[model samples]
Target: MYIPQLSNQKAFDSFILIDGVLHFFQFTIGSKHAINRGLVGVGEKYGFPKDMAKWHFTFVMPPNRVLKVPQAHQGPLKDSKLYSAILDVGVEIPVE
Candidate 1:
C-alpha cells in the first residue's frame, strides 16, 4: 500500500507498506535531505511506537545524485538503518 503526502508542508513525501514494514519516504530533487531522526519523529507524531522495528525511512533521489550525510546526522541514521533508492528516468511505479 502507498500513501502520498497530501500537503506540501508535510514532513515525508510518501508512505509505503511492503511486507508488513512501514516505510517513510522523502523525495528530493536537490540537496535537501531528511534525517532519520526526523523521520522517526514523524512516525511518533502520528502515534506509531518509537521502537517499532518494522518502521523504515527511505530517501529517494534522482540517479547520480550523491547522498551526503552530515556528520551530525550519521549516528541516528545508522541506528535507524536508513534505506535509500534512486529514481531514474523510464522507471515506472504503477498506480492502481
Candidate 2:
C-alpha cells in the first residue's frame, strides 16, 4: 500500500504481513531523511493494532554528500572510518 502526496508530499512504499508479522519498507519521508519518523506518522494515522511485537520496519539511510570536485582533488571524500568499518565487518550491519 502507498500513501498519496498528502500534506507531507512523501511517499510510502509497502506493507506486507507474513507469519503474523507486519513488515514495512519505507524510503525517504521526512526531514530526518529516514523512515523512522515516517513509520510513526503512518502508524498513528492507521491506528495500528496492538500487535507491537509483531511489527517490523526497515528504514533507508539518506546519502550525506554530493558534489563536483576537480580531477586532481582527492582529499578524503567520504569518511574513511565508516568505509573501513564496513569493510571490517560487513554490509549486514546498518550504517545509519
Look at candidate 1 and tell me the lDDT of residue 69.
42
Whole-structure CA lDDT of model 2: 0.41
Worst 10 residues of 1 by lDDT: 69-78
Per-model lDDT: 0.62, 0.41
- Which portions of model 1 show Cα errors greater than 4 Å? 2-5, 18-20, 36-42, 71-78, 90-96
lDDT, candidate 2, 11-93, per-residue tens: 34555667765666545323333223344456657765334545555444344422221221233212111110011222243
Q: Give the candidate number with the greatest TM-score.
A: 1
User: Ten-residue segment with the worst summed lDDT in candidate 2?
Assistant: 77-86
Candidate 2's error at 77, in angstroms?
38
Please identify model 2 stretches exceeding 4 Å from their true place.
1-11, 29-49, 62-96
